[model samples]
Target: MYTTRNSSSSCTQGGFNLGVMHIGAPACGMNAAVRSFVRNCIYRGDTVYGIHDGIDGLVEGNIQEMTWAEVTGWVGQGGAFLGTKRTLPEKHLDQVAARLREYKLHSLMIVGGFEAYHALLQMYEARGKYPEFCIPMVVIPSTISNNVPGSDFSLGCDTALNEITEICDRIRQSAQGTKRRVFVVETMGGYCGYLATLAGLAGGADAAYIFEEQFGIQELQLDVYHMAAKMAEGVQRGLVLRNEKANENYTTDFIFRVYSEEGKGIFSCRKNVLGHMQQGGSPSVFDRNMGTKMAAKAVTWLTDQMLAHRREDGSVFCDEASTAVLLGLQRRSYVFQPVIELKCQTDWDRRIPLNQWWLKLRPLLRILAKHEAAYHEEGITVKEVEEALD
Candidate 1:
């Protein structure tokens, strides 16, 4: 077992040094989160270090002290300014710990999604073997997937949704003009269907194929038949929103092929993969505001932990336990949750349930898309029952 000396005591003599890095896929508003965190730390009289190239940088000991002017006006920026990597830190724990000590960074603020959190949890669990793993940390979820557990919304989700909705709207317009085309728009979500589901609802997609809904060949056949029936009923131009990894057996091309072949007389088909575009574009107002709020809270939390480590005898104890937390927006309120509770073995197997209210939107969207008349009739039936009871 490797042991780390209590070197953080030196940070108490001067202001504590904090580190920031981005990891996992690049998402809009990451720079905004970094900017806000850097500004807040500076404002609070702390030194901020930029970990270039994420955890890989830490392993390589590539670090640079950051100043406020360097990160000014970055709230609207898209992608990560610090540069992000998909590398896991578990393989390089010793080097990462050594780099932290070399820079004397007391805490590190991670700005990314699932993979980043997993790395943080791994480090926390390894604290017994590698005492340097005891460094306090904070994670700000910034994935377009919106799949991070324990949060209603992740940073950059709104911006990505906005982009997807806009692209779908344009595609719908083109389909409408053709008057006999069904546009299939494939979106990014990996296994989480939150993006596809919500974008379909907001974009008025005729149907959505999401991971949350277990889809099969039979379901696909039925969906195609229903879409053809809708076309026969004078509905022209349909939009289908699909999660990229929704169904392993069915690909976007396969879906388009089916629609083109089966709906021959009723409609033609076109496929559009919105690939990385969803991850680009300026951060939306929601993202900007959320990033700022979350980043500031993270800085404050880290600073408080540093102060708490001060001994009454004027000596600083670097070995003092620090909280490792994730800052998230839970039900319209900001929450600082323990990272241990948020840990999961796999992204697909979420530890916390996704927003149930948002999940409810999935079925509601389906009803709005394919069963509007039945929905309206059901509403009327409920109204009639209420009147009879009255």
Candidate 2:
């Protein structure tokens, strides 16, 4: 059953009835985005509807009118205030359109990740079948995995990275206190390794195993040998960051065994799986501010569409096909692009290519990790190297 957070009186005095929902995995800063959108809508004299449990609520006709006063102090809150679900809207297209009409929603603000965008694409394709589904929508990428395409950074990524880095820092401290110790920390990133890679880079990990880089027994052996060699050089402690899905053949247990057992007592290994803990935490200032910024942009775009549909007597003339856009930060700049562009061919394993900048940034992370001091000695700062890489 779908549920509403805070119910209010019907919003009959409406300029534009905007609906908002959070789909996919729950992440920090989701509430912030919701608050920002609601505030923007209210400021513009538009009515806002909070769809509970994401698209499922819309399908079930579960929604509530939201006002700015109710969502105060939600910017620092974690998780989705209106709730969320993994279900896609495409499966319930007819019901979704009916609910949209029932609530008189002119535009929808989807706060979620890759699956949300895919749902948007499906809705686009199903437009001809369900003419009432022509409501304009905007997607705000908010995932801890940071795997959403067309964006350099997604909301909740910084907060999640901070959590992972803090945990890795404590593990590193423990490794330092113990002789011949190596800490194998597993981080959450699904098939993408953005979280693992960034955590390793930020936490000073000796090595990181991510899905972007192929990993097998040969590669694991080399990493083990490298850590052993570093230990022999009196490094005392070594940290290895491993993405949860880095390799199908290699598990965290297997890696620990190879280091502790196969290394012949050279190092005492421990594994710390930073699982869902990475997804829970108060959002960082960066995430709060970024969420507000992105949400504001989405509201602005939505308002523009509403204005375009406005009639002479203040009634909004619903259009034939609504514009669907994905708000993202591409190359450190805010940009909105059609959600259809995010769709691409996937392989047998369901692996799709990520942003090109992320692909380039992956190798640079390794270079910066290994040769920061060497480059510094040559009057080449890490910032310069990063610029060159970019």
Candidate 3:
């Protein structure tokens, strides 16, 4: 016998009823958005339910009903008031189907990322097997990596980027009075550089190291040493940005050696790599405002929007990118603009900071090249020489 947990809450507005279930990780920022939405729904006299531990809870008949007051003020909180889990009910499809049928859930607001997508797709695929498993699901991509292909940005990216920039700003200020200091500040980016690149631009770093651009350690060392030499001469301040996707210890140690050799005081902003505390802070003002707006829209979409779908693999797939994803509207379009305002066309005057820094250190590059006859002795390519100079 398998058991699952689920939550249920109901509200009525204008003689119409509404019900919702939340299923996703609390750390990913969907919880706050969903909580905000739930509160709004209750204010508007709509019903809602919290599915504890995500879809797994939905499969086991473990459910608790909730009300607006139960989830109030959660908009500012970090973790989900309704919990989450990754367990898929595919193994026990029948049990899951039976539970869904019994619960008579009206709509499920899945507050998760790719995993949630897959889970919902699977659940929908199996829905035909059970007569009782029929409900509309709206998916909210809430991953920190901000790589949900269709959505412009994941739910939590704005808040995460803001926090990263705040940290970088504080660190930059703290570096004042320190000569030749090179801090390799690391930020989270599992498989995407959106966060790192945006943070670097917003934080005004001298250089941004991201997975999108493969950076060799040897080149980084030479570059740091060159920068340190310049800083020692007169340039008192500089910033080196690092994305966590790359090797953390290796990069930090390499940059630290350059600063240590120059006798410059170096300090990195202390942070928990796992980021539990960082993830738990109150949502930023932007997030709160956006969250409120998104929640209200969600109620409208579920009630009035005719969600379109397409057939795939002999089955119908709801347009995840269009219907479910909540990329905030910008100028009447659903898009999340990058934190760093990017110019598609390059301006010589606005070259990337790394390129600008390299230009500043061109004289040093020439000085270092005088000792090595790589162009003549090794017949190195122009690209190699350019890279070496950088």
TM-score of each: 0.88, 0.88, 0.67
lDDT of 1: 0.77
lDDT of 2 by residue, 106-151 (tens): 8889998777777777777777777655667788888998877767
Write the candidate numbers in order of decreasing lDDT. 1, 2, 3
lDDT by residue for model 1 over 1-390, one digit each (tens)? 111122343334447788999888888888888888888778767789999998888888778999989998899889888889989888888898788767777788999988777777777877777766666787888899887776778898999999999888887776545667789889998878888888988888877887777777767777788888888898888888889888887989999888889888778889999989998678999899889878877776677666766457532234332366777777657777766766542344642244434665655676668655433423434444343333
Cα deviation at 130, candidate 2, in Å, is 1.4
How many angstroms is residue 171 displaced in model 2 relative to the true structure, after the best TM-score fit?
1.2
Best-fitting candidate, scored by lDDT: 1
What is the Cα-based TM-score of model 3? Answer: 0.67
TM-score of 1: 0.88
Q: What do the candidate models score in CA lDDT, each in turn?
A: 0.77, 0.76, 0.52
lDDT of 2: 0.76
* Off by more than 4 A, model 2: 1-14, 311-322, 345-353, 368-389
Candidates ranked by TM-score, best first?
2, 1, 3
